[model samples]
Target: MEIHKKFAHSILLLFVVLATSQYSCQAQNSPQDYVDAHNAARAQVQVGPIAWDDNVAAFAQSYANQRIGDCNLVHSGNKQYGENIAWGTDLTGQAAVDMWVSEKPNYDYSSNSCVGGSQCLHYTQVVWRNSVRLGCASVQCSNGSWFVTCNYDPPGNYIDQRPY
Candidate 1:
């Protein structure tokens, strides 16, 4: 009986160790997680060799911000003037026309040049309340300062028809 108990105990210990090791190994850190950790550590001391994912995300965000800023410039305030009227406090027939005209030019990317390997362009259009799409007002780069045009039909077609 004593020998049997010892063998059982050893088997249990071995199982526990194996399970723990498997769990730890399966909980690998993602690329984004590594980037965040490295950036946080760099706040205290200089770190070398930044991850590629971090660079790509940063570049994408910067390009998006630039496009949004430009559109907001003409549509921030005074709805009846520029692109703001579509989703602003005013929605006149003339305002709708102006919106379409604004979207017809380079504001829509029909022929984008940023379609390559690691240096491709991605666009995120403005959507309202998880529904109505506000269309694309600009194209942004994920790794460089390259951009294209973007827009949708009927210009600023908002299903909710409200600007928040």
Candidate 2:
């Protein structure tokens, strides 16, 4: 009976080991090691916390000894969805200018009310599309992305202290 119990325990351990092999199939590491590595990677601030100016500076430096202008470029983080890449930094705040240059329209505005204010939490009325309707964004941080709830003002340009 003792020998039989030992044999069953050994088989169980072997199965556990084999079941975890997929996580470390790329390299010859154990499942515990992979979990540790994953935890370490999660300790960093997600994408949105990155400074755009720093990124611009580094990118510029790579080309020349140039400095990224400190025009308060969007302090957004990197990610799969939200990345406030300055589509165009033109002096003239023309709506059409941005629309023309952007391949992705610079942003994807959500449909919301503007009477009084907007339901958007963190959007800025950057420019006027028509009159009251303006561009806004709600900044957020996610996995390697700076997500801002972007949108325009058609229902009335501005966010009132109300939920829509």
Best by TM-score: 1
Worst 10 residues of 1 by lDDT: 120-129
Which predicted model would earn the best lDDT? 1
Candidate 1 colliding pairs: 107-150, 108-149, 108-150, 109-149
> Candidate 2 on 3-41: residue-level lDDT in tens?
999999999999988876532332322223322322222
lDDT of 1 by residue, 1-164 (tens): 99999999999999999898644432322344333432343333232323323333344334335654232222322222112222222222233323433332222234332233322111111211121212222222333222222222223333334211
TM-score, prediction 2: 0.18
Q: Estimate each model's TM-score.
A: 0.24, 0.18
CA lDDT of every candidate? 0.32, 0.28
lDDT of 1 at 148: 23
Residue 57, candidate 1: Cα error in Å is: 11
Total backbone clashes of model 1?
Answer: 4
